[model samples]
Target: MSVYTEVGRDQLIAFLADYAVGELVHYQGISDGIENTNYFVTTDKGEFVLTLFEHHDFGELAYFLDVMTFFFEHGIPSAHPAADRQGRYLKKLCGRPAALVMRLDGRGVANVASLAQCEAIGDILGQMHIAGQQFQSRRHSQRGPEWRQETAQRLLPMMEADQAALLKNELAFQKGYADLDLPWGVTHSDLFRDNALFDGEELRGIIDFYYACDEYLLYDLAVAVNDWCVDESGTLALRHYQALMSGYLQHRQLTDAEQANWNLVLRAAALRFWLSRLQDKLFPREGEITQIKNPDAFLKILQQHRHQPFSVDELQ
Candidate 1:
């Protein structure tokens, strides 16, 4: 996360006046993400998070906010967007589209995640997927099939020979599975460790709904498993995998198609993140504290999933 837009005290005071959140006692820029500008805001009434969209416009972002709202209304742990005095959840701040959301009382898993934490994440994810099935909104992934292929083609020239070859091969391998008959719905496509909040042993909140989109439920699980159940070397940690899969399977059962295509979806998840990291590294935007993650880390992950045929049947 990076502070792309800087808001001054006077500017914030003026912005807060539009909302009936009491007097703003303090506010500070939050430097944790790469997509949007965020700040932790405290007022006499309550604590809230101020987010300014860097990439999404007001129209395009409404779907994501609605998705979060849907989950929160259904008693899920996702944060609720606060409405202004005029009952609008979105407004302009410092020339950027902005909104305020209720901040949860938990922080992300510090450093390595515990087995219980991994299982908890899987449980919440399964629940969210179940909840998402009832949500009527449909927003396709901005970084789905077309973007992945186009981005890989655009970045191949800047990559090492092996990297280029690997990307091409993976893209080709994944292209055929794009239209499988699968259980599809909204997915938290980017549920990395930093995105989930934990209080003690419980996952109290799930933030960063900007990447949530219409996708395969299984693909979403694979995305979560890829990050939550991997080691520093990008290999699967068997116990962590078992815990996560166990947590998810308790809520929903996987079909034979979903089970058969599990490894491919895992590889697809790895490839998507790898291409995105590579894109960020090569064409980064200017921000106060935008983090540029290592592309090679995901490259190793994709290679591991591709070369090693780790069967889902072996998961138990």
Candidate 2:
């Protein structure tokens, strides 16, 4: 498991004292994610997920917790942050910012998602965007254009000529749309397949809101499509794309500006993942259980989006 900062039983018990979650019965490290140290925690009161922020500070962590709470209250099937006895969702455990959230009751679908699954994901994602309109605080995307440009420069030194060229070209391409006045709202910036949980075909829950921020709403949809609707060859599947778009439009219709820039936003989504993966692979952090995803997968996906931009009617 990815137990980067191990928590002793004594320390855990002390931490639980701040909350009314009863006694800590057992806990196990979750190895799936790379951003934070997570544990599937069981208590006498109920089951919850314990997280210790490895990189983010307490102030930054508060925004994510607030967003999660907002979504849960607004009927979204997202994990709700469990506030402590003091009514604070944010806490300190092992000298790191920590939180306890209700454990979702489902497993992540690691394999390719079915069309039904894609539709469900799209539907819920659109609902999330709609519900997020009421959120008060604004957090800019951490992986926005500024980060992309800086990261590209840092990774170019370690990349080959072709890889360097692709990164630079895409970065420049994204710069042109920096001020395109797209629909903005709280977006789950990293909504991949595993980030959602399902039971059979039913989407039980969506987890990991640490990457949630203020960004283009269509960009969020593009992020979901690039992962949930793409085939093994990194090409967008027509059937899956249609299903996703159909499901999304059922709840929220795209603005005319969003429609006009759909192709560009899709490319931006691909570039975001591509740049992140390359950065992670090239300059990995020291963790107990690190899984560096294949950067080339996103590279291919970006290329495909660049070459085969889709139209609105194609999705319908």
Candidate 3:
């Protein structure tokens, strides 16, 4: 079910020759991404990441590419999609869309163990949120209430009747408490630590913009809080949250409404990923190498958020 075509090798070589001639002699699947097929193309010029858009909307993807370009120009560390000779940010390959980008310099650290690392990520994300306001294109959140209802309906066919009911109940919980007054803007909906890269003490780049969309800005912060402040066991790591919130507030302060609504937003963020992982497990897309994330991780996150206070003092 691999979407890649060996037929494109010669054409790819021809294309790269213009931008990175005599550099890419070998290319192989890195296979790290859960959504797209990524290959690390090595050349005498340097390394680059070639990504094939898979099971994702091309229009949204194009918007994210423009977002990356804007962030990169504004001193945010990110991989801007490379334009082709015709000045196209996107290129057609083997009947699918593809893009080439400069390889980020660092590796994705599985955990943020140091306060400095957490603070650095928070600062960078704050900068991104500030800069995101400048972007004109706005995409509605993909996991909005309507999306949850539709996905639950689709998932019902694949799960036990009881499990489907449980999903419905969770969906209700989300809808009843949904916030209408939270700040809305572009967000990297998937801001897990794995999507962030670190080079020494510096945050080298944020990758994987496929999930970027217009949503509650605090939802983005909530996603980051869940990632940086939770241990593998799902317990709250208060110090990590402290450093992250401290650095984040240095750029933009959370409004009282945003703070008051933060806890449920965090729960909703947890529910969002939990439902996505469950759906992916139950009804995986064709041509996808389907592996489900640990749903318990987010469930634990939900539990931890239930008791945590969302006071200004919490922003240490």
Candidate 4:
């Protein structure tokens, strides 16, 4: 849960009326994200998701919204940015920038337990990567080496002796694979199971574009592998990985060189999230629900990847 400053019912109603979308009959704060404030808004027209701009750049967010709208038109299951009375994608509310979007009808898969679930995730990710190739706008972000370096620096103070040593060694290893050639495109940046929703057994929609930026396409897949292929005990779930990779390869094929670099990508992904969580832990942002994801989870992943290597055979 995150901090959700309540917008008065009358105010929201007034907004809907001004926008001419409908009367905002009811509204409530959504408490599942760490980046921005979300609200479940229902108007006379229909139900929608209202997001308030917080920490992220508004211009970048506007670009992201456009991209998402593009995908939505092309049959990608996503929230479409709604327009106000002036036909604007963005609206000003209470001195904050806000936008309305269609609410996705599904729940998050917090614990993806089965092989079919893994395959579903893989298929969706593959589709996203393929569709993302046409998105030409560029917004830069750190993913591989630079991200690890930046995060390590931020977490250096909070980490204990052993964790610091591990981070150093991991950095060195990541640098070795930094020169590998990989396909670049717009990446979701954070596509954990929670970012996606399943309408019953089918993957319904993908949400949360705050971290969407231009980066190595495989890094996004790598993030998914690290997130979806590990068990609770920090062990590699080989069968699940196999299902996911199979589903992914069905759309976008990986080359031998790309396959070789997968290990590095996985390690980089692990360290990236680990360092981010550590930063959050050290500098807790002022919020109602500070969502400091478990950095130790990815730390355990780095340790696990060190000894028990992941291979294409493992994926199969």
TM-score (C-alpha) between model 1 and the true structure: 0.97
Q: What is the C-alpha RMSD of each candidate to the true structure, in Å?
A: 1.1, 1.3, 2.8, 2.0
Cα lDDT of all candidates, in order? 0.88, 0.87, 0.75, 0.77
For model 2, how does the per-residue alpha-carbon lDDT over 1-316 read when each residue is reduced to its tens digit?
A: 2457888899999999989989999998888866788889999989999999888998899899889989999999999999888899988888888899999988888988988999999999989988888999999889888887888888889999988887787777788767988889999988898889999889999999999999999899999999988888899888999988888989899888888898889888888888887887778788666667887888888899888877776667
State, as a TM-score between 0 and 1, how close model 2 is to the true structure: 0.97
Candidate numbers sorted by lDDT from highest down: 1, 2, 4, 3
Q: Write the per-residue lDDT of candidate 3 for residues 1-316, one digit (tens) a residue.
A: 1333332578678767546335567887653545676777777877788777765567767887887888889888998777766777777665567788888988777665578888988898898899888888988777866776787687778777765676676677678555568777888888777788888778889888878888888889989888788898777688888898888988998888887777778888877777777776666555433334676688677766655646545555
lDDT of 1 by residue, 1-316 (tens): 5688899899999999999899999988877767889999999999999999988899888998898899998888888999998999999998999999999989987566789999999899889988888999888888888889999889999988987887788888888767888899999899988899998789899998999899999989999888888898988899999999889988999999998888888888888888888898899988876777888888888888987868788877
Highest-scoring model, TM-score = 1
Regarding lDDT, does 3 or 4 come out ahead? 4
**Candidate 4's error at 218, in angstroms?**
1.1
Please, what are the lDDT tens digits per residue for candidate 4 over residues 41-159? Answer: 88788888887777655676787788788778767787788877678888766656778888888878878556887898888778888998888888877445677687678777767
Displacement of the residue 6 alpha carbon in candidate 2, Å: 1.7
Give candidate 1 misplaced runs (Cα > 4 Å).
none
Cα-lDDT of candidate 3: 0.75
